[model samples]
Target: MQQRFETIEQYLEWMGNNNFTNMTWDIEATGLLDETSIDYTASPYKIKPSYKHHCIVVEEHGGNILAFYDGPTYVFDGREYTERLPKASSMLHTEEVVTLKDYTPVEYIHLPLKEFKNYVLKRKIKRVVAHNMINFDLMSMKLVEDMDFTIGVEHRDGGLTTWSADTWMGKQVVFDDTLVISKTCNPDLFGGHSLDKLSRRAGGDTKIDFRKHLAPDVRFLDFAADMLYYCIYDVKANTAVWHWLQDHEDYQLSDRDNYIKNWLSPIQLEKKVAEIITYQEHRGFVLNVDLCEKAVKDLDAKMEERRARVEPVLPPRPATKKFMADYTPPKRQFKQNGEITSYLQKFIERIGAQLKEGDDRTMIFEGKEYKLPLPADVPLKTEMPAKIGDTTHIKQWLMGEFGWIPSEWKETDLTVDQKKIKLPMENIVAKIDRWLDVTYSTAYKEERLDGFGDYMKITPRSTRAYVRQRLIDRASKGSCKVLTNPSFTKGQEKEMCPDLERIAEQFPFAKDVIEYLTFKHRRSAILGGGMDWDEMEDGEEPEKGYLASIRQDGRIPTPADTCGAATSRMKHRKVANVPRITSLYGAELRELFGVGDGFFQIGYDFDSLEARKESAYCDQYDPTKEYCKSLMMEKPFDVHTMMAKRISEIIGRQFNRSPAKNVKYGLTK
Candidate 1:
């Protein structure tokens, strides 16, 4: 049996078999396909045929796939083709294998100058294809001298070879049917179309090589305005051809228009061509640079002209105001004080202030008496104030609500207890400018505020500053949690806190406090600041009176009581809802007034079809009366008339002009 097995092994060995099919892996090969010695070489790439469950081996020479070895010679599932190999080899003969070949036909023609001239001299060939070749032939020959083997070539006629342009350029086409030459060709106006770019040449260098113009990422913004130039070359043969690019009329608009339109500029088009040239480095496809320059110049000129025509011209201003001698205030009528009172309340609220009730109809604010309704939350007190040393404005007092100082509040009027809360603006101006450490880090740790156990070395200012900066940066950057789906509810905010926590870590100082304060604490705090009608109407009018001072210099109202009232409301807002408070006035208290630019304007008209259709803004202070009637009714105290009359008196004193006549309407134009 040993002698018989040895004879069988010798017979199998002579069969020229090495197992390409394996026991360790699927699919191995035996030596039989070498051109030099019939030694089978393994394929460089594994191939997956559409129907086959196993990967086949494919071989290539010079980037061209030549052949693939068929499978079933190797079974992947625990079956050893190596062990079954001798039996499998019994089915194959040497004649069954076939060699693969490159099938792409060479289309370009190339020849030495002598051969090219001779061919021209003989005039045997009926036609020749060249793109602007009359002048570019010599340039093409120079390029070939530098990139010899890199240029793909195939020998067709004896001593003459054709090269495939597609092989080097990937795939390119010259569109000619859709070419147009109008102002529209000036790229800026009609871009983001099917055609990449359509530009015209005016006066400039005509020697621009166009292959240089192809961008790595094609930026054909205006299909109609850009010129898509494609060139095919067989440089050694001194031959080249070009196609005039045009738009495909039937091409559809895509969602990517916005992204691509910006790249359609004349300058961008020139850069794009250069980009393409860089991408195809080994292939010496130099575009016509002179033509590109010409196109750019022409585009610039056209753009200038378009601008000149469309540029707006301001009409000369009238030398004098146009007025009719008979002109009168439009149908003066008494406006109901009810809407005016509500409007005043809303307006004051909009300014971050509220109305407080007083004795005998006086507005009580910070223990002071005022003729106007003071902000509801302001404390009612009357006492001498704490002293501010060596100050230009004795009335100014530093308040403790985040860089907020009531400019109108007399520092002397603040009691000694209140004086402690006053932060000196001048003394700390430099420190504030330098961003000094105001946060009580060590103290906060000592106090052991809830959720701050991790803070050992961290300072209060450092943590608060970090949180403040994070909030500031987030607001400045307009960062917002994307509420992607309607199903997302408030419950998910706690879950979302982890997401904010990650963001906070990226920004030092935010810790988790900033995130908690903004997302969770904002709305609830604002609700707490809502008007407390009971407090405002509770107190009685006083002997001494205070009225809102109208500024004669066209400045916004700056009543001291109003300022005090605003500070109180802001304090409540901060305590109740920091996020909503920040939203209304930004992170810093000073920025709310300072950044908003002193003027306070709020519009609350309840007209319009949306209001009528949905009754969106409809909410009854009193619902028994008709909506229009209730809206138009005056306040029982005639607040509007009284306020307007007082304001008119102030204006007359300053400008010697009466106030504009008040007007009323029936909720229609």
Candidate 2:
């Protein structure tokens, strides 16, 4: 402790002398990490540079600590750090520290990174430990230091909400995050993976509510000491927690020393996995920005053109969206005008007049055959998508399919096409035999979909049962599809959503909507731009595809979560595959990356997560895990709070608070 580390060499030498095998580490940073970004080069660019890692503090078992900072060094004694400290969230621990009304400065030695290359090249730092190694710390090391790692499971020990594992193995390192382990491990034993929580639980100097004094563009020199203080304390806090975990021998993945010893191979694989994820997310893919922007514009225009034509004669429909203010965590039930049951019933019957019941046919999922009812021949004026798993297929086939083409199929151009090779009928009776052994199936809309429910796996003959159920759902509700199984944020969470695909089977509008959603997907994903509630509130036209997610360093961060524990199917996952969030995107919404720093902010109403989980769809969801419990027993708003929280953050609105005028006003816009 008496010897100081002004350079990485001195620290490494000191660590070697003490025979320290691993180092517990931490860091502090500033800026919009991901999702949102700042462009300093714009015309009249008044934006300040933010979004960067500040320091890396490493602590060895011998109580020796070293810190690396690219910022200026500061000299000082003890000064006031402030009395009115920001209230600590459950995740942060600051209740034990005393402060003054202002920030007190302290002297700190800066360790130059000059020797970092040698440290890594020579593998001098044989092992590294830190909280959130996968998400932040390790990721930072890879990006800034070019240090590669063999990523492992987010170390989770079933106890100490913060102790990832109730017992931290002395030889192991804490890298990944609490998030992955919480859901992947036994949910009951999982506490939480938070620095402060762990520090407090570990009975040590906890994490500082650094944000209390944190300000825009002033974190560097102005609050250098404090920022550095926070950095060092995190390392200490993490160290204490690690020791505490080490002291307690709780459950272990094996009989060996620790998780690392038992599964060293798997543990090492984690860093490599993290590396690949970082590559796609931080370094990111070179987007065809121009091509993407054009897709968004052209598709959006086409959707509008189609909607305009269908609006006039379309049957009176139920008001869409069961709840309102989709961007706010708290929800308000939307006023749904009564459904025109009579009119809908009559029209649907009118079209069904020509369709008779056909023989039952068989289809397979995972080699299991299901004999379903097939509708008899129904005249098709034009070929389009189909609506499956519905009681009104025959009618929807005619009306919902051609409702846009003729506006009113019965009154206007109901005239049949003369393309029947054999029969002298008018239009080709699209042998509404979607359930029968009909050859005209849109099930193969995809070439080979392995994730989720083997999309289009039934046959080259029938409509998808699950996708149809979701579309029929979209007709009454909005975009919410259904929860695939579980595996959302918390272990209990799950949602299902697929914008437009199989529905292109029976619905003509599906074509336009599908194309539109695809472009919108690319705009948000590849172009690094998406419209949120605030932009809509400002009446600012939605992002026509801006380079918003791109950072000053020029990369889009699209972090991926590893979900091998929940579903061995996806070794690399992004966003934890939350149905509330993932379901609404295109299945191809993979690998849209630009790296900076950001994480999915989780928010949810625990009461009725079950109900909402059954209301979404994920392309990568496992259908075998689907659960449907009392769907009737659910709140209109509880299911979508997580989704609402994400939109709130993206739009720069604090909608997660008790209630918000930001959300209320945006609803109108």
Q: Which stretches of candidate 2 lie over 4 Å from their true place?
A: 1-16, 29-54, 67-126, 134-192, 197-205, 213-223, 244-250, 253-262, 314-547, 550-557, 564-669
Q: What is the lDDT of residue 478 in candidate 1?
A: 29
Give the Å error, residue 195, model 1.
Answer: 7.3
Candidate 1 lDDT, tens digit per residue, 341-449? 5444443444343345433334333454455433443322222222111111111111111222211110111111121222333333333322223223222122222
Point out where model 1 deviates above 4 Å: 1-163, 166-342, 348-354, 360-669
Instruction: State every prediction's TM-score relative to the real structure.
Output: 0.14, 0.42
Residue 388's lDDT in candidate 2: 20
Please give the CA lDDT of all the candidate structures. Answer: 0.24, 0.40
Which 10 consecutive positions of candidate 2 have the poorest summed lDDT? 406-415
Choose the strongest candidate by lDDT: 2
